[model samples]
Target: AQSVSQHNHHVILSEAASLELGCNYSYGGTVNLFWYVQYPGQHLQLLLKYFSGDPLVKGIKGFEAEFIKSKFSFNLRKPSVQWSDTAEYFCAVMPGYSSASKIIFGSGTRLSIRP
Candidate 1:
């Protein structure tokens, strides 16, 4: 079965700290990767996504991810984080071959940034 893994369950950092949340998947075929953030009491918002074309894709809020096929990794990174970046971040994967493929989400990583 295909699945996603987020190594960090919770990450706490002060403002301006560099952030990198690990994400890996166990799929053998083509896949699309996504990073979604859900702020406190808010709906999930798309942070970044990687489908085709580029291995490195940038998303909203100065966030980006690199899709490394050799490692089955789609790690999210931000040079510096803010207190407002506090939220639950999820790493998701969907098979690219199928239009109806259900997205598999990792056990979220909760980010807490101190002001």
Candidate 2:
């Protein structure tokens, strides 16, 4: 079965700290990768996505992810984080198979920023 996994459940860091979260998937076919973020009270918004070309995708707020086909992974990274960056992080993927077509999210990572 096709599935996506996020290794981090919770991450606590100070302001301006570098951040990296692990993400891996098990799929042999085509797929669409995405990183969605829900800021404190904000709704889930697209951080980035990997559709066809370009393995390295960049999103808003200095967030970016690299889609490594060999590793079957797409990990999120940020050089510096802010207090406002605190939120829930979700790594998701949509397979190429034709079904109802749904976006599946990782349990989520709760990020806390301490000044």
lDDT of 1 by residue, 12-109 (tens): 99999999999999999999999999999999988988989889999999999999999999999999999999999999999887889699999999
lDDT of each: 0.95, 0.89
How do the predictions measure up, each by TM-score? 0.97, 0.93
Cα lDDT over the full model 2: 0.89
- Candidate closest to the true structure, highest TM-score: 1
* Residue 6 in model 2: lDDT: 88
| Worst lDDT 10-window in candidate 1 | 95-104
RMSD of each: 0.8, 1.3
